[model samples]
Target: MPPLPPVKASDSRAARLVLLVTAIGLISLNLRPALTSPGPLLSEIMREFGIDTALAGGVTGISLICLGVFGAAAPRLARRFGPERVILALLVVLAAGIALRGTGSFGALIGGMILAGLGIGVIQVLLPGIVKRDFARHAGTMTGLYTMNLCLGAAIGAGLAIPLEQTLGSWRLSLAAWALPALAAAIIWLPQAFVRQSPAPRAARPGRLWRDPLAWAVTCFMGLQSCLAYMMIGLMPLILEQRGDDSARAGLITAIAIAPQALTALAVPHFAARMRNQSAVAIVSIAVSAIGFLGLLFAPPSTALLFAVIEGLGLGATIGIAILFIVLRAPDSHVATDLSGMSQSVGYIIAALGPIVAGLLRDAGGNWVLPAAFFLAVASLNAVAGWYAGRDAHVLQDPES
Candidate 1:
């Protein structure tokens, strides 16, 4: 089929497009910190709350679960109220959740994270659809930009949260500091909610993607890969600290592990778009991650830092591809919306278990090695899923009707 007609827009639409890209970039930066900032400080939080690692896993797991649950609802919400208005509202919700987390109460922190995750969930599901709609011709490049900023956010949080907490003399202030960015994003995004969406990217009937086997393949590929990425985000520092690295050093190692992600996140999508199929890239990327992770988990302590950068490269590419598939596998923006919702909603729920499972294994076995085994297995499964999902085909042509 011929490519969907390019968006023919008024010159004003060009101006709007520039603003939308900026808003999207800023919003993407906000997405990861709410989840990542706490990772570097997990030991401190655990000490303050007197909880074990398994329970600490809940800090990230709860948010992941929220992503799954609320993500499922985003498409319906967008369909009713329109994506822009809903995104503006959710940005406010994200800011509120971040501020709530600064309250320093255990209950408050978990509750805040849930709220933040819910907000993130909805926005996450909706933004890609907007990207696919507005930036159809440059989906891969735009996706790279978005994911690059997202990983940059992750690296910033991992590297700075601990230091910021130390410098501020209060973890609460450090945690709450993230709220400023979220609010700023909201302010920038506010105009979008009111701006013209004429020639809007809507289908008369945007159907569910849950029924298609290809959609499931894409979802599993996204989820299984995320399982590894989020697991590292949620636990890598703690695991390093346990190995006797100081908080600063541990955080630095974790930062190094993820810093490369920002680069790969941008570069991979650009390269993947040139491939015949993503299958070869998928297996190779996952294998590279497994090798790096195994070295980090079992190799000499001195090599951990080196292995981390390797792992980061693999994780970054996988995530970029997973997201690209959401757009590529679907026939158009409408289906992309449902596919994004389904893949992330279901995919993140699957990912939510990664840390919990790793936590349990560590708690029971008294080492990170067991979790390494888990990561390797998940990486293999992710490869298989990616192979199937990477085919050059759409999920199917018709709506449920």
Candidate 2:
């Protein structure tokens, strides 16, 4: 390896900054669809495999767990190989995982999901540091953009999976189609990675993130929000189905619930930046999510779309706000990296419980009401955690401070 180039001030005048930010946003967009797309197709997958609902939900939970587990290791990999190269390599892994998932075997499906989850986890953990390093002054805006693209990707995957499955006459083809985007992102990312490589670089010493209380607070917020989001993605369709909605309508409602997130992703961080403290924003976002969950629990099937939109907006805003916390609460780039690792590592592990608990709840009650209530309770906890985490104070070990 060659010595890393020394950090120097560069011109981030408007035009160049826009280009850099756009590149980063596009790369981040490639991370979510594969993980989210499976949810919309859960019914079909269950039928094909002749499995019960709990098992189908477990498969999604397994993928999330893999994401959390693999995300914890991403920083070390980035340090060793460079962040850009790690991203490119992960994209390849993501593409291969998507392709293998279409194998139509239970074992292959589970294995592919694990691989895909790992790829997503690695990308998610590294992107924050990439943004902080590359757009130091404009980290908030860039974080918002990256988050919006992620939500957009999820919306597209959720909205289109059903249609694609129908058009191709098989869910396998629909699932496999996502691999193209991952491959294209890899190809585009390759040149950027090559252009930015340095032979050697400063080695950051690892620290005890587990011992940090603020770190745990941030992690809890991340985990709790993720739990709500994934639970909705995995179980919303079934919830709608039980209400006497047809399969197509259920899928459409799920899409509607996720689609508004793109707007929230863009708006939340921009607005949150104006506030002195993010605690108020976090409180409102989580409250909104709670309201949306209540709507889903009590609203009639005819009004499900309305509830979905409400939930989508809250989910989107919460995601943007969470990313904002990663930027606002960290003292500097290195601290941001540490915060990223801590939040994502523990957060994801916490998130993995959502699908499992929701699945078990459904199996126990044979209905969506309990699951909705469970999500509401989680959202409440998230709000509390976010309140503490959204403070302007820096973590104790934040070097940048």
Candidate 3:
């Protein structure tokens, strides 16, 4: 069949597109706050509740596992309903989860985290396909735009949590404050659910994805980079605190370190898209992140800002490239969402292990040395995966070529 005629920019259509893009940015802004906001308040939560590192790590781990499980389920949901509607419902759920998490009960917190993760999981899988479908010609640029917002949202959450607590006289209120953004994003996104969409093709059955090598490469890269991202989210503040910074400063430092990622996330994907292959950029990003990790481990307290800048740039680049691969490697939007679900489901499951394992090592060894060394080794493996994933071929093609 000939493709549908290109969507011309009529007044209403143009307004819709503008709203959609604004909604996308708003949703992207909501994504990271739920995940990163908790990191800053963890010490107070632990101290008040007598929770230990292993248990604290479990909260992050469980949320990641939910992210994986729900991510895998998203394509099916999107195909059965529609991506826009699914996203709208998830946003409400996310807002509710964020609010419920601050109710002062441990069980409530866990339930809230899982609920929030489930919401985030579906959105993560769907956004790439939506971008691919709507902005096919501008996939890389749009991806970078939304992703930059994701980093900015993360930085804001991490940086502000402590200050919010200071002003509000309770960490619970600080955690609940994130719900405001989610609700506002939902209000902006509400218009999308009402727009009629053409029926999507039935999603492929899940089993075949397990057999695809490029899918595996994409999955590995997603998982490995996520390991670094989640590890930092769950532990960076603690790492800083252990080194002599107070909780508030630690959170702020973590925010400053993560801020540079927004710049690289914006620039790298646009430049990388012009290349014949992305392998070099991929490996270099990992190398840069590895160096940053090394500096954070050994550098004096005074150099924290320098280390943060390096680490953020590297992480931002790697993550931006990872998202780009879902679009770049797929043959179409259907394939892109499928590959996204496959990668995120398995990738997040693998990432779920990172924080808990590091916590265990820290508990056992009583120092950060072993955990840092272990993460370096994982980063090395991530470089190898990125190299293969960067090859100039589609997922359906024989990657060996």
Each prediction's Cα RMSD? 5.2, 4.9, 4.3
Q: Which window of 10 residues has the lowest lDDT sum in candidate 2? A: 198-207
lDDT (0 to 1) per candidate: 0.87, 0.80, 0.87
**Per-residue lDDT of 87-130 in model 3, one digit per residue for the tens?**
99999999999999889898988999999999999998999998
**How much is the lDDT of residue 71 in candidate 2?**
90
- Please give the RMSD of candidate 2 to the true structure: 4.9
The predicted structure with the larger TM-score, 2 or 3, is: 3
Per-prediction TM-score: 0.94, 0.92, 0.95
RMSD of 1: 5.2
Clash pairs (backbone) in predicted model 3: none
| Residue-wise C-alpha lDDT for candidate 1, range 1-401, written one tens digit per residue | 88886666676678788999999999999999898888888988999999998889889999999999999988888878888988889999999998999887999999999999999999999888988888888988998999898889888878888888989897777777888899999999988898654234454243445667788999999889888988998998988888789988998899889889888889888788777688888888888888888888778888989899999998888888888888788778887888888999999999999988999999999988789889988988998899999898888654442
Output the lDDT of residue 318, model 2.
89
Q: How close is candidate 2 to the true structure, as a TM-score?
A: 0.92
Best by TM-score: 3
Candidate 2, residues 1-401, lDDT tens digits: the string is 99988655564345455655666666677777787778778888888889887888877788788888999888778778887788888989989998888887889888988998889888888788767776777766777888899988888787788898899888788888889988888876765588666332233444545566667778888888988888888778777877787777887888888888888888888888767788888878878777777787677767788888898999998888888788777666666766787788778788888888988888899777788778878987998899898877766655542
- Misplaced by over 4 Å in model 1 are 1-11, 198-208, 398-401
Rank by TM-score (best first): 3, 1, 2
Question: Between prediction 1 and prediction 3, which has the larger TM-score?
Answer: 3
Candidate 3 deviant stretches above 4 angstroms:
1-9, 398-401
